[model samples]
Target chain A: MRGKHIKTVMVGGIFLCATPIMAAEGKLLATAGLSQLEGSGGGGLVPWATLAGYDSRDETTALLFMTDVNITDYRLSSIGVATSFYDRVELSYAQQTFGLPVGLVKQLSVGEIKQNVIGAKVRLYGDVVYSTYPQLSIGLQHKQLDDDSVATALGAKDDSGTDFYVAATKVHLGAVAGYNLVWNVTARATKANEMGLLGYGGPDNNGYQMMMEVSVGLLLSPNWVVGMEYRQKPNNLSSVKEDDWTDLFVSYMPNKNINFTAAYADLGTVATQKDQKGVYLSMTGYLW
Target chain B: MVNHLKTALLMMSVLLVACATPTKTPISLYEEIGGQPTIEAITDNFIDEISFNKDIYRYFEKTNITRFREKFIEHLCVDTGGPCTYTGDTMLKVHQGQKITETDFNLTVDLLVNAMKKAGLTYVQQNRVLKVLAPMRGEMLYK
Candidate 1:
């Protein structure tokens, strides 16, 4: 009886393995891009119009990413998962831990700041390569702080807020000395301060502010790319000056399943720490 | 009379040489890629690649491989400014009822790239070919 039961279980497992597997490999390698800091698909600091996965019009794709930024005074760790459907829409969730320097933590009695971001993006029009016009997308990131004590003591108005943005991206084939050139422009409206790590709004400003972000990249080959990004920021706190962010990055995609990116990020200033710069390292794994 | 005939023949030969001089234009992309042989090689490689892919192969299940091979070569040649004519049907007409999706279209492009790679095309050469042919995507997709 024992032998018969084992035999039947093995046969059932074999039948289950015969089902088709859906692999979302319709898009080209590296075109989907690395995950942004907020768990959206983009560069290190700014979100672009491209979705997070390689899904095409008839496919669906999902991905997971982890990004770490270590600056002169602080460190941030982020991990997230995102999925795209039919190359049309994307949804993402992320958690971030912002670690304070030991000295600052000792003074403020706070060790870290934690936040969660839920994001959604929709492709509005056109494709990056095939269409005559640039690809356009609109997205939103909703953020909530795990503990509001730090933000409340810092004179922030809210512990939760949302950011809205519209992005346009394009890829020009053989445009730069026979290599592909990609560029994106995004306009965002937000009330988040320091991307919601310091909370939303403050004594200086309680209304949504508009900011601009830009990124340009050169595809050295099919699998390698280098780029730079600049993101303008809003100054909401009067106690500490917030600064804009910039980074220069290199990304490599060995295959469709994985991507690795490293960047020198110049965050300028964060929470009163001046001249904050660091290395940003990230990796993404695609699940079809 | 023999001398006169010889002078006439020499003058006629000079006139023929003068007529052919203006037709010597720069080499075209077809010649740059080694012309018909390379085109045929790419097409052969493409057919082999299609036969191995189940998704793309289904689109060609009813297609006549022999005719496709000939027409594809001619299309590549003409599109590359070669000394040939494309006698095949229009791209839209040929793909009328297929209703190809964007994913499959891109997949087909990937196969073609693989075929070009197998035929030993350099990256730049491959890009050049794609640049010329990429604009036809509007005609092939969703129709």
Candidate 2:
């Protein structure tokens, strides 16, 4: 069933990519970062406040993105769509599938974990570029795990929950040796375990915990960016110790309507699995 | 590591000596952006862009293009620390009856950025010029 859903989403993505192309209007090129895993505008792993796409207050911008991750013992894929309105408000939705190794699937009596996420973000103050102040935004994500039987067996307390975060992003043009620099800091209050794939909360801790995430990117040119991100997670589940996640990524925007990103991610451990390092690839298409 | 440290110390001493030598003159923003010729070229491109942009051209319809261009060039030249005098009207005075919206102001800025790009200014130079101009948005908008 999960495989079928993944295939359907992939087909939908391809269809969207084939839609009639229109020139992206407003703001300069590459000001809006690529969509992150959770469908927010950001780097691969961390969310930034800048809206996706270059459209400003006069226009609306839409984006479709698909990401695939190959880990040592597992595979994860996410398909998402996001829209930015007037460069001030954003709405996004994403579906994620976590595939376990065949041996682990048999041992745990679980085939795969599927999750759906809906997110909304509002720009509160400042501008990401062309201003000295750091742009601030507040975002909320509602996650629901489709298969909670494995999560319950692993001592998860809930199958669904909401995560709230406040993010600040600032861009410094020509800050470092003629290269632009972008800095982001986010604080999240979440109860999700492993981004809610294993479910929300647990036996050890059922309350929401605050987490910190930071990311920095250097613009190698107007079209290329290299960055690193660190996201801290809570160890709420006693059954499995959760560690922080980090990634180093490079993104290239060849034009206004398309961009590609590749990254090396260290997801730490999941369940009993250790050293879950992996490679990630994502492609994004923009529509105006 | 030791070689790196020695290199760092040597560079620090060289910088210190350079700083102690007081005869070096500070370059103004105007000089850094080239002189009258570069500023004039940028102004011409900016005017061309504004004229072509339907969103902003309507605002300039009743005004004198040639005179406005000269005033704008003079304004930029003086604002960038050049040896030119700006005898134009104050920002608030000139834009008082226009009642420009934020969107209009931002559109103008975008056009200006494009003009700078067309004038062959680097991103750093463009940003430096924008820093001096962005603050005027408050005076130019909603009045």
Candidate 3:
């Protein structure tokens, strides 16, 4: 149909305008250095939200797992899994469980708020890491608010939604003094409506939401990494206007089996809250 | 605050781990490989094999693997913190043409390992070398 053709064309335009081919490839950062990049344990897991996985472009079968803990009185945690195959395609799944028991903390408890996401990433141009070229990738994530009742009971107008993001990643810091830079933007059409009840309305003309993040990864060692990410999501609806977050984390991987991470985060300016900072600790283990 | 504390802990832990665990680079890799001469010999054979390989021969037909081999050594050196700089073409650039599959490249890798063995490398050394080379799957197998 023309509709389908138009949609494909639009998507292709986004890829063409936004990035050039690049090669952002490398091994999974071991635990100690990886935790900071994705807010998870190390090589395989990409912290709280974004999922990079264990293998770079050169890795054929990549298996990874990661998790994250938010610092506010509310306990927000996340876990992710990812795999890359055929050198051009990647698959990932993540579950974010929030408002649960703060096994580590004592006060300010929140109920169980769970969100699940399954994503697919495709490489379109260039390659990172050892390649002189850049590798560009686009991905889509179908997310479900697993416990709609929980989100609704907690006051969300719509409980579940799907989000799609296309990103271009570049990986070659080793040539430039061991520093890696990445820039990405994702426009998401979500059903959760207005930051999930934090704001006012549901999905709007703005199409619900968007996230933009830039990460600079440093190679402390080949299997070790430390990086900082500036992540931002727009407030599209009427409820609780969302804020932005900046974090610095270190990722360390001991081997294929284990990884660890620790981070310092600044939950920056919001509609109401001032600068709030916190700490994160997480670990990941893999079968691969 | 807590993040910095954790970093400090990790740094301290890395030192301890670094001391106790030693680097994972595997000492036997260099030894089992029969050191410098053996690696050089295997490197030559690997170049020869790939130059005639039907699949990826186009990528290296015009290029020499001598610098590539030296660069490989330097990559190992830098990764393991030895005194060297890996200033060679990236894996992606070096293997940019002719379409290599995992099977094709892996077979080549195995052949190189076999060559090393024939040249008198130990199993431990072969595995150790493979460990360092295994991460190259990203760009080398582009179909």
Candidate number with greatest lDDT: 1
Q: What are the candidates' interface root-mean-square deviations? A: 21.5, 8.2, 10.5
DockQ for all models = 0.15, 0.17, 0.06
Off by over 4 Å in 1: A1-22, B1-28
**Cα lDDT computed for each candidate against the true fold:** 0.84, 0.80, 0.49
* Per-residue accuracy of model 3 over B74-120 as CA lDDT, tens digit each: 66555433445679878787777747754456447646655666667
Runs in model 3 with CA error above 4 Å? A1-66, A100-110, A149-157, A176-206, A269-276, B1-143
lDDT tens readout by residue for model 2, B20-117: 45433287668877878888888899989988989899999998988988998899998788999999999999999898865677678878888888
lDDT of 2 by residue, A126-188 (tens): 878766689899999899999898788778899999999999998765555435677788899
Q: Candidate 2: which docking quality band?
A: incorrect
Kindly list the per-residue Cα lDDT of model 1 for residues A17-75, writing each as its tens digit.
Answer: 45443557787666788899999998778999999888999888887777889899999
Q: TM-score each candidate.
A: 0.86, 0.85, 0.53
lDDT of 1 by residue, B1-143 (tens): 23323433454355334434443438877887788889999999999999999989999999999999999999999998999999999999988889999988988988998998888887666766877888899889999
Which one is best on TM-score?
A: 1
> Interface RMSD, candidate 1?
21.5
lDDT of 3 at A202: 40
lDDT of 3 by residue, A158-235 (tens): 555555555544443322221233322233344443233232224433445555444445545534657655555555
